[model samples]
Target: MSSENLDVSSELKSDSSFADRTKSVSIAEKTSVIAVEATSTGVEGRSHAAETSTDPLAQPNDELNKCVVVVNKESGTVCDLWDDHFEAELLERLKANGWEPGLKLVKGEEIEETVVAAKSRKIGGLIAGGGDGTTNSIARLMLGSDIPMGILPFGTLNLAARDLGSPLEPLDAVASLYPGRTREIDALELGDRLCLCMAILGVYPELLNKSEEFHGRNWWRKFTKLGSDFFKAFLSSPKMELSLGMDGTKAERVKSRMLIVVPGHFQDDFGIIPKRESLEGGKCTLLVSKHSSAWSLFRMIGNFLLGRSAQDPDLEVKSAATLSINALRRKKVLLAIDGELAKFKVPLKLDLKKRALLVLDPKASEE
Candidate 1:
């Protein structure tokens, strides 16, 4: 049998084991644990303590409204402005709601430290402001924890927040915080690292590297720079040889130009994109692009705009519960998870941590 055929057989066998693991947790136990964690973490019912106390504006109400607002002060455009005014306005809004907002500036290598502080203080919810990178960092911190998360979109292509209908305006989102809604969102775990949106390799990762330079530049300049980078990459994009393992099975090698592993649907101008059908069933979506000409790249983009990229002949799409990627040679490639760029390494493994994140999305009904 061909390697592709063997991979299909292996994938089917893994699905049964995945289902058994999910069925072991009871609904009641899940609910009780989440509630207990929320209350203990400082998010439950202390909205008005600061006002009643003798001290004036005592520590800006850290007790009742436990929040760690993570912002990337270095990101370009409105993110800097957003971070500048975040604390004062956030505290005001939380205070109005009878809660205190804890503000923490995530500076030089302090992401893990801030998360630890929030957990130690038993804060209620985590608010991630800035772009996708900042959001992913905060989400990774709260993974497997019952503490709910809120988004304050301030980055280019606030894809995750756009899906939740929360725009970049801090006070506007804060105003809608009362009677908050929650949704169980999917997460992808690659080795020790957790990704809340997607794990991307190839051309997209390279584009992210270019995008970082345009940060803080004018909007028009940023757009122009991006277009130039895209054209350059499109012209010289090299094919990659990779081996993939699904759900702990043996590996299958394939040659491709790009690979995108997604846990949920990412939004664009093409309307509400649907994620992989088995997303909630403990699986991830893998898209591998075959070697193609410039014209083929244009067609793929056009098809994606028309909401038909999956049907394009040059792309291969599949669903898997767990995936591992290995490069044939040790080449320096770029990798991105939720728009954050990093150096690529060989033997990248992704595991499905199904429905592990509690995201606040008042717009969507609970599943």
Candidate 2:
């Protein structure tokens, strides 16, 4: 199985494919309800024969026995959903799995300092629980390290965890952490900055800013607010003029209002948030909107939602091994690297490197 999208409904018991894997999984207590449940059917599932990555699974290592779990107390899932005994339950599960687990539950302010300190201890693997920003921090810190990352779905979107097919529930995530095989995954690099998932350029982040009002405190992944966000962003988004192309080539450049760079590209279908079938291949697709006019933007999004052809006149689809993006006359551009916003130097080269980071996949072992 590929890892994440598992059904929690009563019908899951009737799913023949999951029979074997589910037998080994010990469901946790219901009293400890998580803010974020697992992904719905068709996302990804904990298939022992993992299907998303092109690479074969690495040998199971005993070194995973020593791990340090870094939890963010400020994340909506942890703060709003988890109970007081959550830490005890997590540690107990790790211990039950034969790991010498050390726990560090810290507030958002101490994440950076705490992660550095934890890495110095030379633990075999680092497990992190928090939002997308927290996931990005650990990815940047431990990018090339030998130790792998195990994710807990405390983020609103939990995109990384969803991709890894790890359990989204708090204890279920910890339960699967040490049991899975470690896999080397791909990531997008920009100068010294690296993004584990996708990156955005232009006014798209404004839509997400308004989305939080609709999201409120219910942190699980949902798209009911996309309509509201689209409406709000349309009214206030500033115009943008950009030039996109590959480096050392002046001929390939094209004008654009926005850019959505994804590793392995999004699924053709939309309405649900876009997902990639695989993130391992050294490939990326640039989804660009040529004009910033309200009508053009509407058509661009309309084509995407309807799952229309990628070769639409208003939207330019460019698949490349590398991408260079810059504003018309600006020296800097606002970039959202996995939901964290920052001003990045223009003429940014978006490069894809395969197996850039090691992560634990919720792979089932033969019983």
Candidate 3:
């Protein structure tokens, strides 16, 4: 589902769809786990002769044998919720499915090392267990490779995992990883940067900046500081004169406070939360907000929250295979790439890599 509003204020918020469930998942003991040996194809666990009727009905075949699960320890779900007991239970389920788990907690340098190691061992499928940023990092490495990837949905929204039809439950998501059909989806690329979800420009990144500070401060301090930052940003919001050029289309110029570009797969019915029905298409949706007034922002958000169309009369929506965004009246502008704030050079170009990444879809092979 799409967010309640396009307010940059909620930019840093992760997916909160399943946040309220407090019951803990009961992890099975290690005695219930099986072990696997690393091989060129994947980790081989258990033997055909030992195959028992008690095993789960959908088990990975030999060609699909080794599945590596790489968890970003710094991710919200892994850091806050995962523990020794959870890890043990997850391993047991992976072993039962004839897959090996390559669990890690590192981000930048160490993540690269892990990908190299997995490739050397010829892993069949790779499962990324973390938030959107972590998922993008791992998926970037798997692009254009034959190795299919899975999503564990440990992030706040788990948007990518949900779009792939993965189960939110850790064990269930893992089991659905293997013995599943692979779906190739588009990944947005801006030179060396890869965007798995959506990209935003203008006030959204400023909101994310304030959000990053809310992590370590007290409630009062954070609230006051955030409030101050919000007013300052709102009062000083820039009306960017942007010229957007799409392939085979004329460049269009508009003055707006923000621009959101997402793959067409993320498009949904009006008033409904935006979700991708299929990842096969090689197109994207561009949303341009024409008004920067407070009332307009509130109205846009209120519409979305009420399950009504949030289309701003001044807003513009277009379908394109490639987009060229240029700040016609200004220089450099603030950009948010998958929620991470940064300064993007003027005249930025975004292209769609259709079917460039192979992902494991839980419902692909379902009856």
TM-score of each: 0.72, 0.73, 0.74
The residue-by-residue lDDT of candidate 1 on 1-367, one tens digit each, is 0122111211100001212333433321222101111112232232333233322122333443555555444333332353213445666675575444555444325656656556555555767665666677778788877767887666665656655666446567665554245667788876455676677788767675555544432445655666678767856877888899988778999888788888854433464232233335566778888847878888877777677877789888887877878888854445677656655345766777878887766354222
- So what's the TM-score on candidate 1? 0.72
Name the better of 1 and 2 by lDDT: 2
For model 2, the stretches where C-alpha displacement exceeds 4 angstroms are 1-63, 209-226, 235-239, 269-271, 291-313, 364-367
Instruction: Report, for all candidates in order, the number of backbone clashes.
Output: 8, 7, 8
The residue pairs in collision within model 1 are 41-122, 41-123, 42-122, 43-124, 47-98, 47-99, 65-100, 76-216
Residues 249-310 of candidate 2 have per-residue lDDT tens digits of: 66355555467888776656664445565778777878776655667766766777776637
RMSD of each: 13.1, 13.4, 9.1
List runs of model 3 lying over 4 Å from the truth: 1-63, 213-236, 265-274, 306-311
lDDT over C-alpha atoms for residue 205 of model 3: 71
Return the top candidate by TM-score.
3
The lDDT, on a scale of 0 to 1, for candidate 2 is: 0.62
Q: Rate the local accuracy (lDDT) of all candidates.
A: 0.58, 0.62, 0.63
lDDT of 3 by residue, 1-367 (tens): 1121122332234433222321352211212223222222221233431343222112434455666667655454554456455665776677776665545444434666666566555556878877766688788898888888888767655567766777877678887765446778898886566777778887767676656532211235544665566555754787778899998578888887778888764433553334566576898878787766668766666654453433556567788888888888655666677655556556777888899999887886464
Q: State which candidate has the highest lDDT.
A: 3
Model 3 global lDDT (CA atoms, 0 to 1): 0.63
